[model samples]
Target: MPAYGLRSHAWPVTHAVTELIAVNAALTPGRELYLSLRHRDSALRIVVWDQHPRHADPDTRALCEARRSTALWLLAAVVDDWGGEWGSGEARPPQQGVKSWVLLPQ
Candidate 1:
């Protein structure tokens, strides 16, 4: 992916996924895709924010998976159930959650 060439396929969201991609593409050296997202749960409300959208239409997500899995599952993964082997055991540390999951028939 070229730095100057990403403006065409770039998708702008609340936080700048495109800018991150551009910066990574320009500064980093590899053919990998980078994804960033945030999910927050407050006393009253829950918020989910993502950067790259599944479809270019930007209307609906084909799956309920979060942004990391969505990018992996849709763009870079060789297999359908990519990134599925990440351990979801109870051994997760204090700061990080063990794993994320989706429980629906897609």
Candidate 2:
């Protein structure tokens, strides 16, 4: 990622990726996870995929709040943009998983 001029964003992006993997590993053992970093145009994108799409129910404010109170918040703070999606049809080949991504200016 640093090779793409992301040296300044690498640490925080790596931390966010690590936390996402750790959280998924701890909460959903035996499931597969994937991490991807891409540099396009003038931006760097970091994405983490885990096989737990419905891990948190956004309909429940309390649960959402609890889930948001983690490294994800810090990730959002450090990146230019960040978001997540629950579905198997995005991020990679068709599969059941959740995709969390952060984008930083290059």
Candidate 3:
């Protein structure tokens, strides 16, 4: 396994690399961030979770929004060009955060 736990054969989208950069730019400083990259069903899955203030909380949603970087706009272009799907949602139970993910067909 590679340092990031991805298989040796796994590779990122050469032209859609902005996804990772945008996710990192949106993260909360000093907070925990988890990343997972894997190949499944002939596609590449990339997920990034951040321990930022949950968007479901109205008061903190603004805080989280304020932390978002304009760089995230690049994700749209990348996804469109690659025919990939990307979205974000609340983390699952036991995890209070957000997860942004993208799926790109191989």
- Candidate 3, overall lDDT? 0.64
lDDT against the true structure, per candidate, is 0.28, 0.59, 0.64
User: Per the 3 Å backbone cut-off, how many clashing residue pairs does candidate 2 have?
Assistant: 0
**Candidate 2 C-alpha lDDT tens digits along 24-88:** 56645798887787778776666667775453544664463356345355555655243322212
Query: Which sections of candidate 1 miss by over 4 Å?
Result: 1-15, 42-106
Candidates 1 and 2, the one with greater TM-score:
2
lDDT of 1 by residue, 1-106 (tens): 1243423222222123343354334322454442434232311111222222234343333232343444433222222232212211111343221122221111
Q: C-alpha displacement of 60 in model 1, angstroms?
A: 44
Off by over 4 Å in 2: 53-71, 80-93
Off by over 4 Å in 3: 1-18, 55-71
RMSD (CA, Å), each prediction: 17.1, 5.0, 5.1
RMSD of 1: 17.1
Instruction: Report the lDDT of model 3 for residue 39.
Output: 72
How many Å off is the CA of 38 in candidate 2? 0.5
TM-score of each: 0.24, 0.64, 0.67
Q: Please tell me which predicted candidate would have the highest lDDT against the true structure.
A: 3
Question: Rank by TM-score, descending?
Answer: 3, 2, 1
Q: Give the Cα error of residue 1 in candidate 1, in Å.
A: 26
